[model samples]
Target: MLTEEGKKRRDALDAEITERIAAFKVEQRKMLEELAEIGIHVEMVNRLPNLPTSDYVQALPILIKHLRREYSEGTLASLARSLAAKDASEYWDELVAMYLASAHRISTGPGNLAMALAAAVAAACPKNRLDDLTNLVKNQRLPHRVLLLTPFKKRRGRDPAVARLIEELRHDPALAKEIGRWKILPSQASLRSH
Candidate 1:
C-alpha cells in the first residue's frame, strides 16, 4: 500500500533507531563493567612488587565507585589504609576529590560533604600513614573560589577603559546576566563597584 520512497524512508528511520539503542546498551555495559575489565592481576592487587600499567584516568571512575560505597563511618579510612599499604601518598585525596565532585554534582544529601575521609581512614588503619592527607586539607582550596580586590578604583591608579567597562557592565544585558548567575552572592553595592 506504500510507495517505494515512503517505505524506504520508514525502513531507514527504523534502522537508525535500532543502531542508536544498540550503541547505548554497549556504552552502558562498558561503563558498568570497567573495573571488572582490569581483572584481578594478583601481582598488582596483592602488592607483589610489580608496576601497574598507567591507567589512572581510565580507572578513576571505578575508583570513585569504590569510595562512595556506603562506608560505616570509617570504611573509607579502612579502604584507604588498605590501599596505602599497596600504593603511595595522597591516594585517598585524589580518590576523595572524585567522590566529592560526584556527590556535589548529584545534588544528593551529602551536599556539605567535607572531605572528612582522613579521620575515617586514620581510625580504621595504621594512623601514621596519612599525615600527608591531614596536611592536604589545610592546603586545599574549594573549587571556583576567587577574591577580587580593586584598590586602584579607590586609590586613584586605574585605567579609564577598565572603569568604563565596569560601568558599562551594569547596563550590559549579557554581562549583567552572566554575573547575576555567579555561585557566590554579590552585594548590591559591590556589584556596582569597579
Candidate 2:
C-alpha cells in the first residue's frame, strides 16, 4: 500500500507534525516562565492543567493584572474559568472590565473566552451591579450575550427588577431566540463540567 512517493510524503508530514509539536511545547514553556517572572508562581501555572477545580486564590490577582496581556486565547479562557470556581465578587469591577474589553473576541473560535468570562461574571456579579449586567446583555459585540443573563435567572424569582429584565429580553426580537434556547438548555454550571 506504499509507493515510494507516498511513503516520502507521509514521512514528511509526520516530521512536520513533530516539529510543530516541539515548537508548541517550547512556546508553552516560555509562557510559563514569563508568568512566573511576573509573580504568578510555578504552582499556579501548574494548576492550569486542572483549572476551575484547583485552588486559584493565590494566582487570582496576578491573572487579573495580566488580563489585558497578549496571551493565547486558551490561557485567557483558563484564567476566566478559574475565576468562576470561587466567589470572585470582590473582583467584580476587574472581571467586568476584562469582559468588556474582550467582548469583540468572544464566541469567535474554539477557546471561547466569552463563555468563560460570562460564567465568572455570573459567579462574581453582586446584587448592586444588576444594571451593569443588563447593559452587558445589550452589547451586540457579544454574540453569546444570552450567557450574561445567567445572573438574572438566579435572581429573577426573588427580585422584581431581574424578573422584569428577563420579560423584556424575551420580548426583544433580537434576543428572543437566544433566550428561548437558554431556557431549554442545561444550566451554565452543569455545562462547564464538560
Candidate 3:
C-alpha cells in the first residue's frame, strides 16, 4: 500500500529509532555496572550518629525541645547553661566549624541554607563564607571579642564551649564591642527582661 518514497522514509525513521534505543540500553548498562561496583553508600550520609531508636522523632525529642527554646536574655542564660554542658558544647564547636569549612566548596544555588546564613552572619564572601569563618578561627581573626547577641538563641545552641564563651563575655567588655552580633536578639528592646 506504500509508495516507494514513503517506504524509504519509514525505513530510515525506524533505523534511527532502533539506534537510539540501542544507545540508551548501552548507557543504562554502564550505569548499572557502576552502581553495582559502588554498592549502597548513598544513604549513609543522611544518618545521624548514635541513634538509639528507629523512631527518630521519639529518640531526639528531649534534645530538640531543650535546644529550640523561646528567645530572650533569660533564655540565653539557659542556652548558655545547656551549651556549657559537654555534649552541647561539642555540637556547637563542630557545627560552626563544619559550616565555616564547607562554605568554599558549595555553590550559591537555591539549595544552600548554611552558606547564605554564614555570609550574612560573618560579613564574609557569600561563596566562601565557611572558608572565611574557618580561616578566621584558624588565623585568630574570629571576632576575639564576640558579644554573641542572638535574637533569642545562639546558632550553635546549647554547648559547653558556648557556655565558656558566655562566661568569658561576662568578664570581657572589650570583646563585646568587637562583635555586637547575636543569634536571636534582633534589637536591644528584644533582650529578654529578667
lDDT of each prediction vs. the true structure? 0.37, 0.66, 0.35
Cα lDDT tens digits, model 3, 1-194, are 98999999999989986765454445334333433344421121112222322323222323223334332222222222322222333245433553455445433322242332232234212322333333443333333213123311243344444344443353445545433454333332222232
lDDT of 1: 0.37
Off by over 4 Å in 2: 1-54, 106-110, 181-194
C-alpha RMSD of candidate 3 = 18.1
Candidate 1 Cα errors over 4 Å, as ranges: 1-29, 40-93, 96-116, 119-131, 134-194
Across residues 76-132, which tens digit of lDDT does each residue of candidate 1 receive? 332333333223333545644543453333233311223333322222222343333
- Looking at candidate 3, the ten consecutive residues that score lowest on lDDT are 40-49
Question: What are the models' TM-scores?
Answer: 0.23, 0.63, 0.22
- How many residue pairs clash in each candidate at the backbone level? 1, 0, 21
Flag the better candidate by lDDT, 2 or 3.
2
